[model samples]
Target: MEDKANKAWTDLIQEYQIDNAIKQHGEFIIQAKDIKKYREPRLMAKWDSSESLPTILKKSDINILPVSRSAYVLSNFKLYQPFPENDINTVKYVPPLPLESIDFNNLSTESNAINAMLITGILDDFLGTNNTVETFNGRMGTNDFSFTVNLTNGGKRQVDVQSAQLEIDGGFENDDSIIIMEAKNVPHPDFHIRQLYFPYRLWCERVRKPIRLVFSQYIDSIYHLYEYEFAKEDDYSSIHLIQQRNYSFQSSAISWDDIQRIIDSNSPEIDDNYDDTSIPFIQADLFTRLISLIEQLDKVPNMTSAEIASSMEFDIRQASYYSSAGEYLGVIERPLRGHSQLSLTGIKLMRLKLRERRLELIKLIVRHNIFHDLLSQIIDTGEFPSREAIIDRMRRYNVCKDATTLYRRASSVSGWLRWIVTLPDTTEEFE
Candidate 1:
């Protein structure tokens, strides 16, 4: 049973893998909203009321300060500590990538994996920071109340889950305490653990402070993030699921069954290199840039690196994907700063723009016309239309031609069709 569960999440992760061809043929959907905001009211109410117990314990236990507010112990756990010199354990499988790398064109599993890895890296950075700052506001209804106030048996107090949303769990990880995250490509019933517990323990071993667990998932270019906080333990062993919010996908409740289904399906790609312990997902930026180059191409006029960059927002690595689309991936040069108004004939510019739009159009057309219909029918129960049969109807019908390609060298008619569609008369309605 345990084996089945673990395999389930792993499988779900793979299906969500951006590298998988399924994505190329997929129609991307916006990720879901925050989970905490959508959890059942009764469940949330219970969680909210649960916090009051801490206050109750503090008042009655009188010794709560000894356990929770020990300045001496906590101060010794200084936040201002420096990062220990790098060790083999901290070795970079992939070194830190610049945020600037985010400026790119299309998407691919490999690039998205890199991007996802970087986002996870930021969490590590926060955990490595030692200095902690307290940022809370306090107000006294009246200092006179201190004269006769009861914190124990009776007092004017109310606790609710209202603080959930505004609550930023785990301060920027004071000391070596990290919020360990296991990222996957799909939903896994057992994924809740791999993406949650294991990473928590791994990081917990690295530092004196407790490690929190997080699960990040990517489905069709969308990222879904979930977090878990442990409960109080006697031997520092038990895990208490304190707070969980599904912020990466849709506004819906996922049962234990939902997890099973996703994992049972295809899963995300995990690096076996790290003893199957720590695996990073594909990055979004690098992949997107790759896609962009494929989307826009030109035959007559060789496009300069700057022209490609303009379409890709200046990511040099991604710009290469453009020139090498379908054949090889290369990095020629990042788009130059200013070339939007470069000297070029109106026809030349039109051709370049069409080349670009065509790539996107091809992918979009395939997704709406093909994958969505097929995947939806198999995964969920929905008979849909295959737009491929009627691609002519929605787009420019009059410009029909023999063939069209995502690349620039497809044919002359392709460019003419694109140009004619965007032009006035004979073009759709407004013409």
Candidate 2:
């Protein structure tokens, strides 16, 4: 049986087709279930007798015309009105604790993530405010309230928010206005607009002062804050980013020379008997990108693979790849099958000073016999070897046990080691 949402969607499709009153507005997707149905043997059998599959599909109730196996559009689909595009202009500012010289020991004691942001003084600079600040947390209203939200499918319906709990990570009421903030340890391409809208509405109803919605993120050891506002008062989806700024403290935690020294010290000792199929071989570089992901896990411990994927800007497969890389590095662990959580080593790294943290992470990788050997070869040869070289190197040790598995792990080996060759310059300006 179809669920309520799918059934309602079917009903909408039927009504529009029967009435010939389709509105070419709003965003909609042909549900995956229907797409799967179209792939059935019975459905494929009819393809030869009929016109092209997309032609037949257009006449059906699904209301989508397939452009390809992975692309499609509603029969009368029209693009949703897009918000204005603005350049993300940034002003560089210095952090109070040279971002590089952060004392992880002292920072670990701070229980509140918001306070930690404040102490860094980056928040003050980002907000353009040095006034004393006050924080708020917990529910904002005494009674539940019902509201309506515009759906992407060209519809609106009433939604009941119970207690409308307003969990503000960092908020401050200044003399002129109140700033409501949502903070994250890692950056994302976009966040659910409701993170700011719900509080904005609740507080606007309670107080006469204007509310400023701020989204703050800590990525690459820098604090980035984006100010957003709803262009339309009642439309939740109308949220727009108005301002963006980033700040970083001084950092010299790792250098090219440091990476070289570590790579040279750890020579590749082939462990032919080592079975490493449990972990994936790296497919992407950008070690700092992976570190930002680790920082995200540190912020929210024990997230399932799906949740981690949903929280990030990338696709689910990419999320799986990055998480797998973390697992191979031993910085992340999956205690339960299919569910990933930070390992003790990861937790310790999060608590150590920046320089110590960088060095320790290097030590962890170099200590691993497989990785140590790979890095040594990369540093010694001064170039990335061909895929065949990686496969040949792994074959000597019988790592991964089979050619297919060995090939996959080789991708990881080359992908991860590539980061050392192209580490980003930390001293350069950042936003």
Candidates in order have lDDT scores of: 0.28, 0.56
Question: How much does candidate 2 score in TM-score?
Answer: 0.51
**For each candidate, what TM-score against the reference?**
0.24, 0.51
For TM-score, the strongest prediction is: 2
Deviation in Å, model 1, residue 229 alpha carbon: 3.1
Best by lDDT: 2
* Residues 1-431, model 1: lDDT tens digits: 11222233233324444223222432111111211233322221111111111222122221110111111010011011111211111111222234565521222343353344345443343233434332221211111101111123233221111111112122234454444444444222222121232234333434677655544444323333445564532112234344222211112222323323433443323211212222111112223333334434421224555555444333333344334332212222224432112123222322333233333332322222222223333335433223442233223322223334212222222222222222111111110
lDDT of 1 at 164: 17
Question: With candidate 1 superimposed using the best TM-score fit, by how many Å does residue 74's alpha carbon deviate from the native?
Answer: 41
- When summed lDDT is taken over every stretch of 10 residues in candidate 1, the lowest stretch is 70-79
Q: After superposition, how far is residue 240 of candidate 1 from its true place, in Å?
A: 7.0
lDDT of 2 at 332: 90
RMSD of each: 24.6, 11.8
